[model samples]
Target: MTTSPLAASTVTADMVWIPGGTYLMGADDQYPEEAPAHPVTVPGFWIDRHPVTNRDFDDFVRATGYRTLAERTPERGAPGAAAALHVPGSAVFVAPDPSAGAHLDDLSRWWRYVPGADWRHPGGPGSSAAAIPDHPVVHLAWADVAAFAMLTGKHVPTEAEWEFAARGGLDGATYAWGEEFTADGVHLANTWQGEFPVENTAADGFVGTSPVGVFPPNGHGLYDMIGNVWEWTADWYAGHEPPRGCCAVRDPRGGHQAGSRDAAHPEDPVPRKVLKGGSHLCAPNYCRRYRPAARMPHAVDTSTSNLGFRCVVRPGHPAEGDRAATG
Candidate 1:
């Protein structure tokens, strides 16, 4: 594969070359969004070895003076603008009161829109990334990830590309590493250990986002592909159509913008993008979406404490050509 121009300049030592191939892109029996398991083939590309870290994002912000969506206050006149969304903040995972009995259906029981919960201040104003520089940078919306990608001459991976690399050549495996969630009673990924929201045993040695690369790498030598954080993808969130009997698709992109709106919040009109790999909040009793095939729809303008992204370098892209010209 021809190398991207940014590969030489911006591709850090933590980036790993994913030799791509065909794979079953979705799960047949899982969530409806990931159903109709289809075959998809993707070209080889380089992906970050782990989710973008606080240090990496800090460097980007320092160089470009960019502001994340969570750091910006929402305009009042926008369609479906709620009073609660007027202030600048991101959704933070707040543990529910153990005595009150956790409500699984009510997400508000555990999620709160803190006033100053951006990437730098993950838990609001007082919190800082100073102590967790190596942790994955969270609270990034789709536009924030896009800005970073443009600045670095990289692009966000499409759903197909992300899943292909995440599989690590293990076709139809339940997890990135294998069928088992753990081996010999050892946790593989940084998923929730106990009951959701109320209790966390931290069996994986972390209650929240752990430092990237603390866990074992997948077969492709990629870190945190399944958990630790939910990663942004280029694909717009749309349900997959069932494939024609036993046929594979070539480099399938996600749905169009018009169809990417969330059905539950149709009045809002903010388009949603696909988020993959689950997060530290995922648990067996709650969100069992830590698998490679799992996917979630996140609004483009809505950032959360568990959301972040990594960049990908595709071979012979026009963006790379543009970067080369400017350089």
Candidate 2:
């Protein structure tokens, strides 16, 4: 087995060295998508200590002149080509009016396709990243994240790698930290504390994204692995289909792109990738996905207020040196 880095200087301060190991990858008691929990092994690698912040992404943009997919206008025949929503935009979370009696089943009650909402303007036109520079940068499509990875000479972590690191060596635990969602009323991560899409108690001192490292880190010293914002993974969003009788899967990636197309909107045909962790919008009454084993599928072209990403660098890979030189 590869040795873990002993000194922080060996890797960038923004990243932490994750010692490779085998761990239980999914949960059988939670969402159906995470059924049949199985064993998965991943190699040692360096991962961002927290989600990528607006300031971090801004630096990358300034250095590479890269534009996020959300900043570009959709083609005439694109899936979301409705004249009203066809303009360059992203999906932002807008809490529904509680008096309206919005139902949790209908996502449209809280999500809006807001024009001019991108990484720079998280909440539409007037919003800016000036004050919350350390907040995780949201509204990023898969292609946008790929662009960031290319510039930094890093790569998105595979589904197995992401789960392994998020678990923080606590195999089969209900959360990244522990079994309890909150320990003795103390919130461990940023998640909805009140009714979903209606009320937010802000008990955790955040209604939306919180500054990175605001919460306690996991056992592996990784922060924001369970909540803050959903993180992108390299694996395509296909149902987990483990080998029927296999003992364990080694470095399992994911499904094919063709298989990851949105079944609900088959006509649109845009492929989706796996998104790990939950977001501040996750709540007990609503999306109960604030766990390391939880996973979601998002269209490659879709971006949202609660979605962002971090990158990984495998040991012995040149990406770390390349990133250092670029800086």
Candidate 3:
């Protein structure tokens, strides 16, 4: 999976050494937000081959006695806290019946803020993550993800770093594996098969999150880089910034915190972070973001059943030294 000439001394069995280089960061043909494709360079780093699974997260929780944000009740008087936030819960996807004349535009028809719905209880009260130990752990907010990374001595990948790794050395390609969405009519990633929100044909053999590494890995040996679940990156949610002059930006990050505020509702200013990789909920008819250049914005304090993340260990970082010693 090594692509560049640079060598990595801290490669591990569970992590892939992404030989970093420059690549087109965004897409100009797909969604408008993904337009203005620009060139960006990243340093070589080690990234988890797959998104953090339930078993991996469970180990961290058991060792550190960590309770995720979704598991804690939010303060009623906290700024921007709504009545719904007073309860311990996370957003869960519940498909609406087409027979009920479900509105396609109203996401509330499909997403519900369920009480008691956290990573441990993905389906609210009775569901358990232990039953699907191999699946990517969802319902994690930014704070929870940061805490996990800190405990593991790893760091969340920035938007540039994530996109570079997702490309898997195939710069400017539409999908992670190549331009084709599928190979010989076989699904390569877990994605929606039918009309979104109401119908899911499950052609990929999954109605929700699938077990990690079930699909073929990308050129970098990174699994689930394009689907299964959207992954959080360490960047604020401002649109792509075009490169200046003719030089490709090196190790570019994201916008400032003040600029990351969601402008959709001026009355409620909540900051958002960039989320990469489309989830199993992605479909051609709806969110066709199951590509290397695809990205979305999500509030920092919010968590969803379809949102998850992976960790990265940059060269010379403490995590890199830890991996080198452990490996």
Candidate 4:
């Protein structure tokens, strides 16, 4: 199914197509490394109904002026220790228990590590972008989303093409539009509804990041994917222990070096190569992972204001192909 010459062209905006097949990938009773539900497939591609904005990476830095490693500053073979990267930087999730006070462990207490906070100042100093220019541009890192999917030719969807476009085709049923994270409590996504390391009953309006397209958009339409932030697949995390128990399996490259996980899947801190999606402190009492086989393992240079990315379209569109998927 890899026939995309750009696939008859015309698809790019908001991104869609998905079309792949096979489902029921994991979740053997909810996170035993996402348990033996196997049977994946994948093939047809194209995804990004939302989740990569700041006006589309600010029009890819206004067309190829491209620079985001938090905005660079090291120069010539850089990798750390220029006074800890002089300036230009990222990673910001601070809230280890504000007035909400007590959000469980709060991912090592609200994931701080701020340098300059990329994605255009996401809470690093004053946090600007004309005041959140519609938000959803986060710090980014897997080498700055593989350098924005190789300068926007596109190439960041593979964890079986991001759970076959986040199970928009539906199969094993469980959230993403099935299961039931909320019947009366209300919250289809945008997690951590209550006391994690504190309290964040944002209820869905959102306590942080949340504007890319609002909600109610699966079945391939896309939107939030599962919650709010946590998408960066390209696979590089592995943690198998299947047969239906003992969590951490398939496309879970969260243990090679990135976001490190696999201490049976949750002590968070050992994953690498990036792969976050719908789980910004996800909570059903404590981390639901949002859905579509929820994953986490970011750190390919480490960047996150909750991380963000989206771009796909490869079936056939090469009259002069350049902006393969954008409005």
For candidate 3, write residues 73-149 as lDDT tens digits.
87775442347558888899999987876366788789888889999998899999999999999999988887677
TM-score for all models, in order of appearance = 0.92, 0.91, 0.91, 0.34
Clashing residue pairs, backbone N/CA/C < 3 A, model 1:
none
lDDT, candidate 2, at 224? 95
Q: Clashes in each model (backbone N, CA, C under 3 Å)?
A: 0, 0, 0, 39
Write model 1 residue lDDT over 167-283, tens digit each, in one string.
Answer: 888999989999999999988899998888799999889999999999888989999998999999888888986666676787777887777887767876778888999999999
lDDT by residue (223-287, candidate 2, tens digit) is 99988999999888778876556667877778877778666667767788889999998999878
lDDT of each: 0.83, 0.83, 0.84, 0.64
List RMSD in Å for every model shown: 4.4, 5.5, 6.1, 18.1
- How many clashing residue pairs are found in candidate 4? 39
Cα deviation of 271 in candidate 2 (Å)? 0.6
Q: Candidate 2: lDDT of 276?
A: 93
Spell out the clash pairs found in candidate 2.
none
Q: Give lDDT for model 1.
A: 0.83
How far does residue 70 in candidate 2 sit from its true spot (Å)?
A: 1.5
**Over the stretch 281-306, how does candidate 4's per-residue lDDT look in tens digits?**
67767777787876655545666677
Looking at candidate 3, the ten consecutive residues that score lowest on lDDT are 1-10
**Residue 318 miss distance in model 4 (angstroms):** 3.9
Instruction: Output the number of the lDDT-best candidate.
Output: 3
Name the weakest run of 10 consecutive residues (lDDT summed) in model 2: 1-10
